[model samples]
Target: MATPDALAFRFFSLQVVRTESLGPSLVRVTFAGDDLAHFHSDGRDQSLSLFLPAEGRSKPAVPFEEGENWYQAWRELPDDVRAVMRSYTLRALRRDPDEIDIDFVLHGVEPGAAVAAGPASRWAADAKPGAEVVLIGPAVADNRAIRFRPAEGTDLVLMWGDETALPALLASLESLPAGLPVRAWVEVPHAGDVQDVVTAADAEVTWLVRDESSAEGAFPALDAIRAAGLPSARKPYVWLAGEAGRMKELRRHFVGERGVDRRQVTFVGYWRRGLTEEQLREQPQE
Candidate 1:
């Protein structure tokens, strides 16, 4: 598979064309823009950063004309005017219509609580046709951030993801070669969040419905993975992404307890339990 280029980021102004609910907690939003002609995705687990305008605003006021160094410009803006930026995977890309589909997890408001909703989730839940946003993505198809590169002669694939990483996991499953041995586990909040995933690969996917009543810091999926034995294969590639803390423990289990070669595993911490993406990024890397 082709790899993405390094440091290739471009800005595009896109408008929402349609919206659909994929499951109980997932919303699919299709965006279209004339500038998308230059947008090319590497496909498997490709991700991009999005800038959403504040409520009641038609479009984000980003000073893109200041050139590729928009990050500094975005930061220079006053707190109230600056847009809220977040990262998300490109669920699907269609060049025919010059559009892209993004799946947003709908974290509904808590009943009888005064807590503020997540900016991205709130925006997605209320997003409508013609809603405009800005995306910092790749101009070329092979730009990096795809991240699902398996080495040659790999015999089996092991995957695990939480609801936040579901889009990327599903995308990778759909692209695997036919009849390839694959086992995947996806954990979601409810059984209704499970959706039929179409893939050509001979893959067995287990849906792990989370127990919300459980005490904090519980790692049910990690426990389940520890209880199950890995499939026999000469060379197995493991890919893991989800909550940061849980993923760290899983990495230890696979590399230390299971004796899997560290080089064969690709692990990423998509998010942390208590920290927002911004806060997570601020901390030193582990």
Candidate 2:
């Protein structure tokens, strides 16, 4: 790990510095380490591969000795020993002390939750100070992991996301140029899950709580966005993510019905209904 490749992604060993309950369904975990001196990111929707320690293990079982081949090496380990890897976005980054915050959605961890708790969710729910984890993140300030690319001439921005995409959406909003027009929508399971956002962008954000009327697979936000009509912009960038099935519907509505340029739309399926991250990874990417 002495040299960073052209891609600029490298492994960093970090430990939990603190954890805070953001809401009923969200938890914020802050991590720091000496290795963080090398970590850098430009922020908007930056993706990171987090490796949590396997159950009963002290630290994540990452094969750092294998260098760039760490992914394959770690995968070859026994299921019980291998670290649990999950994708997450950087909620915030600070330099003075070199710390990063990641927001995790705690599904099924709440009292009498309907859904089941996944490993990552459970890890986040009970995370404590000094818990060690490994991260595969950008070493360079700007890398390919960021997806919120607003075209130069864009006059307005359109964004949509569910709880899973909340961190990315908020980070993107915070990074946008001041006074930029932004129309954003967020869907969360509980009203208590709503977060107060701080962004310089001239943004109008709406939170939609999922209920019986609006089922999991239903793209209810699409209808609301469609009814509001597109903001007046010659060139507007659309970024929508979370819940594969619903995200697809939003993309279709923007690109097809409203005629937003497909290229200008950055749509990502952060996760899908009833599918674990591992299962989602198995599906072919668009």
RMSD of each: 3.0, 1.8
Tens-place lDDT per residue, model 1, 1-286, is: 2233434667899999999988777889999999999888777788898999966677887888877566799889987788888889989888787999899987754455344568888899889999999998888777667888778999889889999899999998988998988988899977888989889988999899998789987888888888887778888888998888878888888889887788998887878877888898788986
Decoy 1 TM-score against native: 0.94
lDDT of 2 by residue, 169-221 (tens): 99999988899999999999889999998999899999998785655456668
Error of 2 at 109 (Å): 1.0
Clashing pairs in 1: 4-142, 5-142
Winning candidate number (lDDT): 2
Off by over 4 Å in 1: 1-7, 110-115
lDDT of candidates 1 onward, in order = 0.85, 0.90
Model 2 CA lDDT for position 113: 66
Per-candidate clash tally: 2, 0
Instruction: Give TM-scores for every candidate, taking all chains together and pairing residue i with residue i.
Output: 0.94, 0.95
